[model samples]
Target: MTVTDGVQRVLAELQRFGIDRQDVIVSTNVRTRLDGLPRSGEREPADSGAAVYWQERTGARRVIAIDHYIKVADNLAAIAATLDAMRSIERHGGARILERAFTGFTALPGATAPSWRDVFGVPPDCHDMAVVRAAYRRRASSAHPDKGGSNDEMATLNAALRDASTELGKPIGGEGS
Candidate 1:
């Protein structure tokens, strides 16, 4: 399919997730420096392609830039993969998913760090070590690697536990104690 066709497909997929076409911007004219450095005016044309930018209603924006000089098929494939991921996030997490998907960081919006309180399902002011340990144990039981869970999940749990311990001033697993 043509680049325009690919763009239309992406836009249509985003629209299905309640994103408006007007909130999407497609640009085919982009220039870059040849020396791989940022330059001011009149840089060389990189490729014959387009960049698709979508801004969600909640102010999260993502840009997908494709360079068609390599292969149009590859570009189209990338677009398809991105659309599939976006659809999955929207289906599972709704519009709030856009913030995490576009930001490259899993922290909540306007927050510099991911909250251990949120991960452990505790109140922000909760400082009791017993409460933190109880929450950690419950989460660890379900997220343990041997219980059909992933190593990544276990690692995340460990990190959250450490953070929660530190936040509560009760060091566990030999961290900050």
Candidate 2:
């Protein structure tokens, strides 16, 4: 399909994650929507990359800013699915939205660091299950799709939890996240 088609599909899917398009500010590789508003004459810096924003002003349950490569064609399916998985945190009222947003960003073929920078901020060297169950779980629950997050995000969390548990020698359903 075309880029416009992809963008439209993405917009439609965002609703499923409880992200209202009205509350969004779109800046596509091809155009900008908030142009009518007072924009700083300055454009995004060279490496800043493209992004999608959703938030309270947009009346969304949460805001998700996704970074992507402009050269590659956009894929709405995975994005929609990811958002759905992430709904647990994005749709509900809470702040874990920050971590989810950062951790879950994807990249098109040629994307760079934004796509690979441990968005979750969890260092590979850091293995503190006690911290995950006690602090991380509480922090993440605020936006978990099951609790208030989107389906896509909840799915992502499920996977991350599984990975963390397997390595830590714990079950996903255990007392920790």
Which model scores highest in TM-score? Answer: 1
Candidate 2 lDDT over residue span 1-177, tens digit each: 444455565567767655666765545344333542112233434443334566754444443444454331243334444566666555574447676665556433543332111424466666766554454465367557658767766555555655566777876556653
Candidate 2 residue-wise lDDT at 86: 62
* Poorest lDDT segment (10 consecutive residues) of candidate 2: 111-120
By lDDT, the best candidate is 1
Give residue 119's error in model 2 in angstroms. 25
Give a tens-digit lDDT track for model 1, residues 1-177. 544455557767778868887787665543334532222333334454556677988898988876755544346446656787868876788668566575566455664555678778988776776777788789889888888778877877787888877766776844333
lDDT of model 1, residue 110 = 69
